[model samples]
Target: MFALCDVNSFYTSVETVFRPDLWGKPVVVVSNNDGCIISRSAEAKALGIPMGAPLFKFSDFLRQHGVQVFSSNYALYADMSLRVMTILEEMAPKTEVYSIDEAWLFLQGMEKLVGWQEWGHEIRNRVQRETHLTLGVGIAPTMTLAKLANYAAKRWRKTDGVVVLTDPERQRKLMALANVSDVWGVGSRISKRLNAMGMKTVLDLANADTHLIRKKFSVVLERTVRELRGEPCLALEETPSARQQIVCSRSYGVKVTAKDEVRQSLCAFAERAAAKLREEGQFCRCVTVFFRTSGYDTGGEYCSRQGSMTCQVPTHDTRDIIKMALSVFEKIWLSGPRYAKAGIILGDFYHRGVAQPGLFDEIQPRANSEALMQVMDSLNQSRRGALWFAGQGIEKPWQMKREMLSPAYTTRFSDLPKVR
Candidate 1:
């Protein structure tokens, strides 16, 4: 059997973890730049405040209802995620982190040795006791079914945040209750098509003929059908592959028209991408810089501009990447347009290392470059202070707005809550 463990309303839940006053209170978290409501607490959901509602449209409504709002605190969220994953890795025989808030645990035949519901509740209780964050636990024979069981666990309050689907009869009952769109891989468009064909629920899709599903849809959907009927089609990846490219971009909080400000933003993005590349233990061979005026109302001749430059050798040094980013920015930076967003991409990663440099390659990596980068990374990761390239600018007027961001309570020492 496999078990899927997911945090309940992760973003808003994280907010409540460190703030005792927020317990049982209606809370919501906004997306980048505090644009829209992305996460809401159980109380907020009960009040019928829709997810993804524009904050400006519902600001008055939320305030009138005593709902708390906060900006996206990515630093705190990421640190909390790491803590939760660490706990799972220590408890489960084998764990696959499915997302920031979901993890898969493989129990194989161990379910027979322990009572299913007892074991599920054990995992749930441990996570809640340690992290002060509630979890929904679902146990089933297949990964897809386990995900469905998790869905049922979260909705049915009597489960007490845990659901086990070992019996075929119980699985079908829960599947029948779930809409087709609620299935693991099925989306809105696919669900609509299935609805038109009289398959409006998960049980309908499970009863589908494997051969017919394969021919009508795809091998992937066929596999999903078999998995729904107690066959494992997807297995856990012990090591997920690194991304082919790292792109860092953000919409400016305020309009930017000056070349100097755009240059600072590009440098900041390049540095962040380089730091990620190093964290992945890989090197990048190309750097791309891009900037654009608001596509909605930019009256400029060109709405966007981008250009790329390659390196003589793959490198993860931030200075090297920043230099290349500046060069590309110069080529694409247009004057007199109100820039609304800027970003940089670092691509062409190498693991086993790239081909040898040419005999006459004029530029070479700096001496002791790797050691120098380690120091910078160490200081930055601590979060107390960071050493940035002077080009990133001390006063970043073009940064994304996070006016309601909470402090990094778990990640930064200065933000730690006082006992009193």
Candidate 2:
């Protein structure tokens, strides 16, 4: 058996963890710069506040409904997610972290266990009590089914946040009731195609002929069909594969016209991307810098350009990456309309020490790059103030705005919740 656990409205729920008064209230968490609604509480959803709607578009509606709003508190949400995953790691020996808000647990020989529902609720209650976070538990024979069961657990309040689909008949019944889009790995385009083929329900797709699915779609979709039929096609990946490319970009709170502002933004972004490259124990050979003007502005010229530079040897050193980024930025940036966003992309990765230098290329990997980067990343992540390079200016006027951001309740020492 496989079970999937998913947090409910993860960002908003994390916000409520430290503010219990917001528990049953209409709440939403907006994206960076308070741009759009990203996560909404059940009550907010009931109020018909659409997800991804621009915050400015619905300001009056939110105010009229008394909907509580907050900027995305990444630090608080990440720390709380870690706590939930830690509990799952201890409870289930074999687990795969699917996302920041979801995980899969391998329940070997659990079919023999009579009280599946009881086991699921135990997980739910324990996580809520320990982490002060609520989640849905879906128990099934396959991970895909477990995922759908979890969706049902959260979608229908009657399930009380736990759904068990151990019986084959029960699984089919749930699949019949669920739309094709509700199936794990099914995209909107695929769902529309399935609807045209009269496979509107998950059960219809599950009953599809594997031969036809492979001929019309892909082998990947065929695997999804098989998994829907209770045959596991995907293995639990405990360790996720390292990304081939790393990108760190953000839209500025206000459009920046000054060359120094754009330069500072790219430097900071390069530093961030380099830190992530080191985290994966990888080095990058190609550095790309991209900048653009606001595409939505009708009165100004829209410009978007990117430039790339490749090093002879891969390096994870921030200074090396930042130097390359600025070099590329100098080449690509056009002096004109205000630049709204800028970022860096590190690509053509190599496992540390695996990047062989060309015979003629004199540039070789820096021997002390790893040690220097390790110390820098440690201090930056420690929540003590960042140790930034001079290239990244001290005053970052182009940073994303988060005026209503909640405190780092879990990650920062000073942000801890107060008690009377």
Q: Report, for all candidates in order, the number of backbone clashes.
A: 0, 0
TM agreement with the true structure for every prediction: 0.92, 0.94
Q: Which regions of candidate 2 fall more than 4 Å away from where they truly are?
A: 358-362
User: Residues 1-420, candidate 1, lDDT per residue (tens digit)?
Assistant: 889999999999999998889899999999997888999999999999998998889999998999999999988998888888998887678899989999999886575588988888887888888898889999888999999999999999998988988899999999899999999989888899889989988999999989888888899898899999999898887788788999999889988999999999998888898899998999888998899888665466556899999877888989999989998888777888898888998899987356676777644667999899999999988753378888889899998888899999987778999997
lDDT for model 2: 0.88
Q: Pick the lDDT winner.
A: 1
The candidate 2 region of ten consecutive residues with least summed lDDT is 361-370
What's the CA RMSD of model 2 in angstroms?
1.9
Candidate 2 local lDDT, residue 292: 90
Candidate 2 structure quality by residue, lDDT tens digits, 1-420: 888998999999889888888889999999998899999999999999998999999999999999999998887888889999999987776998888999899987665764779888898999999988888999888888888889899888999999988789988999899999998889999999989998998999999999999999999999999998889898887678878898899999998989989999999898889888877888889999998988887868788889999988888888889888888888877787788888888999987667577887645566886678778888988743478788888889999999899999877788788899
